[model samples]
Target: MGNQPETHPNPTIDPKSGFNSETRTFQSLRPKTPLPPLSQPLSVTDYTLSLIPSTSLSATAMIDSDTDTHLSYSVFIRQIKSLSSSLKSLFPSLSKGHVALIISPSSLHVPVLYFSLLSLGVVVAPANPLSTHSELTHHVQLTKPVIAFATSSTSTHIPNLKFGTVLIDSPQFISMLNNFNNSEPPRVEVAQSDVAAILFSSGTTGRVKGVELTHRNFIALTGGFYYTNLMLGNLDEKESNKVSLFTPPLFHVFGFFMMVWTIAFGETLVLMKRFDFEGMLKLVEKYRIDSIPVSPPLVVLLAKSELVNKYDVSSLKIVGCGGAPLGKEVGESFAARFPNVIIEQVT
Candidate 1:
């Protein structure tokens, strides 16, 4: 033989359960996913933007399920660039390492602003738009954001900050998105370890605290989802045609990360400004939503609600449930009702 390859013994596994007794844990059988070098300078926005297929640029990127408004990938990218440039010009003091608070409901503008802020290396701190003045103040104290973005209705709740507040609903904000300067935002070298966002806890158990998430954290998360889908043979030539509806609030960690994940794969995301059980079903039927991220409560509702039969939900392929413990009975009922749809529980 010209050369012989070295071989190693297979890992020991229990014959009955396939458990690794030596390590006292079961090893994942999935193939390892390749990640970029840790020392490399990268932002979650850049990583996600790189994953978008060139062909998907013309496809729908987001839809306002309430108003039926549509946003294309091409326009969304352009808006991100434009908004980034405009923010730099408007608030020269806003720079990398600075935090910006975002208090807004689910809207097409939120994602564009999020990507823009991240590209510029600004730390995004998004809070519940429905928060009271005292709650907003607590958030402001925690993050110490220099600038804030809010809507006309929610702006009153936010305390003044260094850069004041930019109302997303104003005509002025729209003009920023339509920046005609043609000059791109100056390139920002964001380290993967830099803080990306500060999201708040639910405050159910105690006082809500700000949770810091780094750029590398999100890059890894989005990457894992991207590769897992590929491994499952979910990403095909028609991947852009897949639609996902988000029932969670954008300010929550579940919704925020999933939003980024959906965009990274160039899938159309449907957002509802306000969650209505019947409205969610209507959107599912209208857009042919393939998947949805749901909480335990939503899962129970889906399993037992009579309204589910009122619409055509045959297109739903997956229901990702997380954020809390799902009762075994609830999971069984949901599985039995939606036999074709897979219930993916995340612990």
Candidate 2:
């Protein structure tokens, strides 16, 4: 980590721009509202600044649309503030826009880590748990994250990439939160154009390309889908939809935009790190999944899995396929086998 660029704990005006790249982006217009100018210089670490998170700030958050978990947004923020203090001692120069890869499995941790980093003006790079060593390496290379927060499960898989890393196995997240109130909140600037996330898209060429999604760009895309689905009454289209995503990586925009955004609203998503026919069928039986979002090849495999008949798939109503066009015969066969399942092709 010695070769790493020195972190700027305080907001420093870029010599050329004389403006903070992070601050400019945050001051830019958001989808719903324009970011207000700061009356005084603000530190990214100081989350109390009403401008950064705007009115989204809260004491408790009611997350867990998939499970019945009562989460508090207020308590969660306090934990993040505590973590920030702990991390400061370990990382003296951490900047506001520094990227951190979150690798925890607890659904509760996702929102906590996400907002915590955001509060510090830190960008997040969420990788798939099933990502191979090579895949993780590519992501590290592309984003050049300052640190990665993960469990011991993935600690061994990080290849030759160079960056500061943190382990968050159970007691660790709490331990980090223990050291609270010692350091200042990060004082970096942010903007809508500044990327909140850079998801790697596994293109048709098989090479992973990072998709730079600015805060506004992401909000627009997610908001568009939200509005379109609402107008079209497709809100429930994915609700309780029992489907397998054989092709989509949650890291990809298609997965996050198409699959995740809906769940944030109210859909109960059956998250599978990777698509396996037998495993998916087992899930269908166990959870009584209603519809599955899949790719063309998986749609074909669904017909072959014959395991579909072994489970109680009567709850399923939507079977979606995309990424490439399926042949008419393949589509017909899928329909014949899943007669009760409505076939949806991406328009």
Give the winner by lDDT.
1
- Model 2 local distance difference test score: 0.58
- The Cα RMSD of model 2 versus the native structure comes to 12.8
> Lowest lDDT 10-mer window, candidate 1?
1-10
Note each model's CA RMSD in angstroms.
3.9, 12.8
Tell me the spans in candidate 1 whose CA falls farther than 4 Å from its real position. 1-29
Query: Poorest 10 consecutive residues of model 2 by lDDT?
Result: 27-36
Best by TM-score: 1
| Candidate 1 lDDT tens digits, 68-136 | 999999999999999999998899878898999999999999999999999999999999999998999
> Could you give candidate 2's per-residue lDDT for residues 105-158 as a string of tens digits?
545555455546655556778787767887788788888887888777866676
| Candidate 1 colliding pairs | none
